[model samples]
Target: MDMSRLIETPLHRLAHGRTGDKGNRINISVIAYRAEFFPVIREQVTAERVAELFSHRRPTKVERYELPRLGALNFVIDDVLEGGVNDALNLDGHGKTNAFLVLSIPVWVPETILQLREEITA
Candidate 1:
């Protein structure tokens, strides 16, 4: 398939994610719903971009770990919890919903992949 042309697509349409928290840190896992979408996600979802996405929280640092075999990406975001569940006044101390924020980032996908995803979802 020709991959020269790509279309803007929401990451949620290509993958699903879950979040976990530890002290002042949150770890989010983005797993492609289909193996075919993994490449598109991996290429566009950068550590810098993830950091930028959570810029409001002023994360100390953002680290991305690639699990190609599992068709997933793990992001460890530090210092976004406002000082952990025990200390933070925030309702989302655990930050379980942060995964959705990460999944909200848009990425460019080849038309072939987009069509394939649409077919599967439909």
Candidate 2:
């Protein structure tokens, strides 16, 4: 696969939000329907790799963790937003910044996984 094209594709942009704080870091929890996708997602979001993927913006920090039981991957990104939850609450009501931050990573998965997620949630 052409990695550059994949990174620049609209799918990636849509999967991940465009507006990132670029100043305050936040923790994002990503749950995959299957364990197989963990490594692929990790490779796409690694600190060094993410910098290149999001070359236009810089992140202060990126930490990855494995949720084996849930078949998930959790990422803690530093400085991806401004002022963290405090600013979000103060400025945007309710005080939740993590939701937007979590939306900023393009989590690639199969259609089956998407269906499974809907099923579980429903």
- Report the number of the highest-TM-score candidate: 1
**What lDDT tens digits, residue by residue, belong to model 1 across residues 1-122?**
66567899889999999999989999999999889999889989999999999998899999999999999999999999887877888888788888999999999988887777876778
What is the C-alpha lDDT profile of model 2 across 13-110, one tens digit per residue?
Answer: 22222232333554555554345444455556555544444344356667766666765555656654445545533463222444454446555545
**Per-prediction TM-score, please?**
0.93, 0.45
Question: Candidate 2's error at 65, in angstroms?
Answer: 1.7
TM-score of 1: 0.93
Q: Candidate 1 at 102: error in angstroms?
A: 0.5
TM-score of 2: 0.45
RMSD to native, candidate 1? 1.4
